[model samples]
Target: MGMDNKMIVSSSPHIRSIESIQSVMTDVLIALFPVALMAVLLFGYQALITMVISVATAMLVEALWLRKRDIYNDGSAAVTGLLFAMVLPPSPPWWLVVVGSAAAIIIGKQVFGGIGYNIFNPALVGRAVVLVSWGGYMAGNIWSPPQPFAFGADVAAVTGATALADQGEAIQYKLSDFFIGNVPGCLGETSALALLIGGIWLYYRGHIDWRIPGGYIGTVFIMGAVFGGGFYDNHLMTGLFHVLAGGVMLGALYMATDMVTTPVTPAGRLIFGIGCGLITMLIRLWGVLPEGVTYAILLMNAVTPIIDNFTVPKQFGGVNKSA
Candidate 1:
């Protein structure tokens, strides 16, 4: 009897998809390429260099922290690195890149027990830390104006504010320029067209659901029309501007939809998105800062577990307690 072997049984969900962490992360990198390409095209080779340095730094930090030689091969560190870089101003110094990358992997991700266990989005955490630590590079007088493929020393040395940064009525950007990504801003926030292309590609591949982005953007559009842009040109353009102007497109499509830190249930996802939109507009309209996508999404990420608990659906054959 002691020599007899017994089969071990495990929990149901006994089934699984063929997809691995590597494949999903690879798809995310592919989706981000259009935005990265647009960043380089608008900002110059310096933008590309920042992205490379950030990615390398993230991979190195994660490898060293976890003592896992294959960490880079998972593609997660690369995704975090690029996402972190996309949010930075064009051509920040190499030290900022290294520091933010390490913080993202070590503090933001690994400290929370890595990947699936993290409460906040690691890239956003990294960005928030760096933005606070080095406000000069993130804001103030360090931004390089878009050069549009000009890689020479023709880079703009003078500091300038983004359109949102200038809250005055006399903002100088043409709507077309912002849409096509000609204005100066963070590497990813400048181009709505590029982000949309990448977002659509991700959606078509079934990598993301429509509910989260739909809720977040729909709420923003409504709020913008109700509160912003004087009624002159049908007011729709004003609403469109809110969606296109800053990181709304990037946040709604990519960061807010992070599967690891967001809700799993459909209704919960909608609530999470709406909550993000509400917080973002509140900050943009009334808070001191011009943009609020990063903090808004991170806040909602902190609430995702609660959202899931409240939004859990009833079982197929279960009767309501009150019934």
Candidate 2:
């Protein structure tokens, strides 16, 4: 028989696609453009500086780790860097951005053998590290209020608290401000409108699934509505406020929907999302922290393998061995 006619066997991932890692990461960057643009528009020059430092530091660290001159290797480092920036305050000290970004690429990703092998989201890991190591810089009532259209303004001089915080002064902002991202918060998480636009773009590109995001956002809304105590106008509005404010929009639409560091089975994905939302609300409403997206998602990431194992579909036409 000719070589063309012979059958050849391969490993488990026999399926193939036209998409490459570079192409996928490129799409993710494109989707993130609206968020980054909104961040710059909302927080001005300092936001731009923070992002540049983060992306640059992440790429530099990854390049040095691989001993390659090409810093943009597969674009994963860039993505991880940008995501890390999104979670940070608009005007954190430059050293903080550099340390967190480097730690993200090194400890969060490279230590796990790189790229597809990482069990936790690198960006969240970086955020968690900084939050724990330097709580003064990462948390509290130090958030800079957004100076929309003031590209040259010094936003860091005007500090405030986020809506999610327990401070009574933080509750003054309207829901409209939260939706349009005029309120004070993290660099990329303030604008629910921009995040929704990016989420739509990602969904269009088939980079995410509805099960995770839908379940996440839905559970958050339901829990907030039932238990939120009608502080923001009404229970429904409080639920809406919870969904619009903080990092829920960014986390539900981007982080929790990560292709890696999440479950593969359909049921497992939904369960993972719900678990994240539940833990997030538990922390936000009762725990010491005001925001919980980072730790919530990280906790769920730790149990992904178990979720998949329990939810995996049985092979078709297979009989039970016990029988």
Candidate 3:
């Protein structure tokens, strides 16, 4: 018995910290505080109700699926549920949210063999499903935030204005509002400040690979400048809005960082980030949809295997004879 006990003890990925799945997931949720608060302030009870319903539905679906598979527990479902809730708009119906969550856990994740085996980010898959199925509802003209959650009804009501609706005139917005997250958009994506805080926290904890975010944001900025058409006004900020206003921050920070879906090699990660950025830009600028981050990430998810094959580290003393 003593010998067996000694054999059972082991060490050596030697770094240790007081973090667990619950702790990390809780931290992520906590980090989302600013955005969640901002979202409730801007959107209202409708958005809040939708988020609650969506997350609850996600958890239920995950539990049911796991029970079916005979696997006891996994925290991924909770993460997926919360992420799905965050990306939805203020007005999406509850049924759509439920269906999207189901699809995320079933088709996008479990079918591919669950958690570490999945090839794509499940939350984005769910968001993409809803976006495709309910285009008009997802992108509506009435995007005013809820007054009850916001400090002042008058202030929340001001978010009703949007730039994309107009043909020639530009919609002006205060940078402070955008930063602080008082603008009109998805539940969690409204506040750049909150997203940045969360992202910084994730980075500090070493739970994420910073290369992916750095590459994605950098590519968007550079491409925005190249295609901006003008020098100062229309170029960078518009692209930045595309980055800031939708699921880009959430995807870049959380979804894109998923170890299973992303490339293993550093170079492969760079490729993945660049591809995500390009596709997002194309969809926003040229495609019919106003937002493209979710689809862009999923599309790149499919191509990660190819990127990894080409960029993975070489074996010792390996030689390239094909040249």
Candidate 4:
């Protein structure tokens, strides 16, 4: 009876779950598979090449640097590599793929103390570095135009500016085109349908919540409708365009919702998403860049800790205001 009455304490880590890091990474990779497949179907062999190179180099770098015999089993490097490739222009030279993958693992992940310790998303860190270093390759006519549903066919060598880059009287894309990925942009970001499929998969697995993306996409829709061109004639259409075009869909779902970089509290997550949208729109409109998802999410990532600190809920039974 005394033994039962006494408090029982086991060693640390008593609570456990079936989920493992490998399982989580595997799910993310699986979710990414359709998007990656769409990238290949639209952009052709160049996309496949870039993905392979990035994955290989990222895994190699991580294993060599850490001297981990089973680094591949952890599955972080593969996810980072695939993500880095997804954000890049599909037609980059082989050397660029190697360089960016190495940078992602070395500077982005390991330099910040690896995996969970990195402040910014590791994949975005690599992409930002590559973009800054080789602006000509990353933007300004480097994008390979998507060939609509032309799977297993020869991808014609064509280059075009993205829909977001066209700030004339109006952007030159229908909602259907964006949905079907008949546009020019990064390999993975062009297809709204693909991204939604992946995001839905993640959501179904209970890996993500809608709040981050909901706040992000909602803010962009609202802001674009108010300040965007052609809103007077077609407010609803204009709002839909902003939501469908460019990297907003991909960024809101995949990049901004990164578990390690985003906030822990619900309010903080919403605020983070809103901040990302605000910065993204500002850069897209006033700033020189046509797309701002990368920098916006990265900037918000830098402030996640502060957001969490202030937004943390009060303890369960203590500090009652009406006590």
Candidate 5:
């Protein structure tokens, strides 16, 4: 008999993407540079320190969990950790951050069978867990930029102020300050310009599905404008402030674009994004929380699988009731 040697290998789509998981993750990190640099510039060294601590903690937790679980050759943990660090407020204490990172790596990722298998965005789940468990600590937004170089020693001793200190009672910033990230908030969330630059890069690279961000931002604008009244400059300004602040840009560009946690089809993704936008606006206008992007994303993440099921590509010559 002729020597028989055949091998069978199967993978997704049968068509290869020029992108590897590591490369995609790397590109994401690169795209974030502009925003990260801007955040550091506006918020100071402490912001950079926060990012480093969060990312480091995330990486350590992810690696340890993977080692414990016996599946040890994926780069996803690094991505999750980096993304988590990018969204956290600068004032988060080290211990709370460590807890969040561990939650992201362990319960959010490895426990779900790693990487692509997770049902939710690991970073968001981790952040959410911290938010629920340590509401007071996590809500501390007292962050300040490095004192000017001339101020020297004072820089080390400065305490950060709260982002929402003047809200309701009085609006302390112009719409412009909020848009430029001059007003206090999460370190990374201050600059709409920087986030937009990063978003444009990701869109150019085709790494992101623009529908999600577009729909999300657009829906928020329309809804916020309607409730707050009209899309004229003043109303639009308020909407812009809301859109550019907090984790809106970060979530739209990074977390909301999570391939595994978001709907696969274009329409489904559009619907998911619109829902996020609507919920964010509703919560911001009337809910207890001042910002709602993270919670909105997580709430929608729960519905993504259902969206995918309904939006799956139609079988050839089959009924398309899902339409």
Candidate 6:
């Protein structure tokens, strides 16, 4: 046989798609457009400013770290920055945004060796840092109400608690408000409608797995319906409220589904999602914080390797360890 006809076997991953990291990250950014647009429409220019600063800081930090002139390296830094902004208050101090974005790219990402090597989601790491360091700004009754296309409006003037805040037996806003994202919350987390649209786009592109989101949202709904007090109309509605409110939609569809940090095995992915939901509900119900999506995902991220090890399927005709 000719040399050209001979088999040229290489290591694993012989079958690879044409996709690159830049392409994958670009798709994520496109999917997040609706969430970003909704943030601006709901919270006005302040949200836009927050996104700009965060994205700029993240890209700048990564560029400087790698000693590369290309600020948009693989586009992962931009995604991390935008996601970090999504978890933030609509109008947090500019300095805080810069610090958190930088932290996300540095400590959360590069410190672990960058992108696919990082164990935790960079955006959540940044948010967790800010939340711990500046709890007053990140939590409490500081959420700004949406202005609904009032681009020039000052949202900060009318601050209030989110629907998820522990306020006894009555939800403050209508279910419609939560679905439409008119209620006060984090910049991108308010609008379930927007997130659903983005999720659909990601799904269509085959960028995400339904098992993770399904298991996560299903667990949250079940736990909410069972344990959540019948605060809003009925237990069913309360469960639905849990699904639509705060970062449940965002975390389930986006953060928890991160390709790099999450597991590769299907079973591991499902378990990861369920674990995230369980921890999030546990924190929201019993922990000190009103929101728990960030920490829940981070904690699950730490155990991803263990989950994958046990969940990986045995190869065909492979011998059993006990045998």
Error of 1 at 79 (Å): 0.5
lDDT (10s digit) by residue, model 2, range 223-289: 8899888788899998988898899999998899888899998888999999999998998899989
What is candidate 4's lDDT per residue for 221-312, written digit by digit as tens?
A: 88788767654247767777888888899899899988989998888899999999999889977889988999999999999999998887
> Each model's C-alpha lDDT?
0.84, 0.90, 0.71, 0.85, 0.71, 0.91
Clash counts for all predictions: 0, 0, 5, 0, 3, 0
What TM-score does model 2 achieve against the real structure? 0.93
lDDT of 5 by residue, 192-308 (tens): 777778778888888787789988988887776667553225677656656665667777877898878889888889989998998887787788877788889989999998887
Instruction: Return the TM-score for each candidate structure.
Output: 0.91, 0.93, 0.83, 0.91, 0.84, 0.93
Name model 6 segments beyond 4 Å from true.
1-16, 168-170, 316-323
Candidate 3 wrongly placed segments (more than 4 Å): 1-24, 68-72, 145-170, 231-234, 314-323
> Local error of candidate 4 at 15, Å?
5.5
Worst 10 contiguous positions by lDDT, candidate 4: 166-175
Lowest lDDT sum, 10 consecutive residues, model 6, at: 163-172
Q: How many backbone clashes does candidate 6 have?
A: 0
Tens-digit lDDT track of model 6 for 42-105: 9999999999999999999999999999899799999999999999999999999999999999
Whole-model lDDT, model 4: 0.85
lDDT of 1 at 176: 86
Predicted structure 1, TM vs. truth: 0.91
Query: RMSD of each candidate?
Result: 3.4, 3.0, 4.0, 3.9, 4.0, 2.9
Identify the runs in model 1 with alpha carbons over 4 angstroms from their true place. 1-16, 140-142, 154-156, 168-170, 231-234, 317-323
Q: Tens-digit lDDT track for model 3 on 134-195?
A: 87656635555435464434432444533333222223555566666666667777677878
Clashing pairs in 5: 142-160, 143-160, 181-190
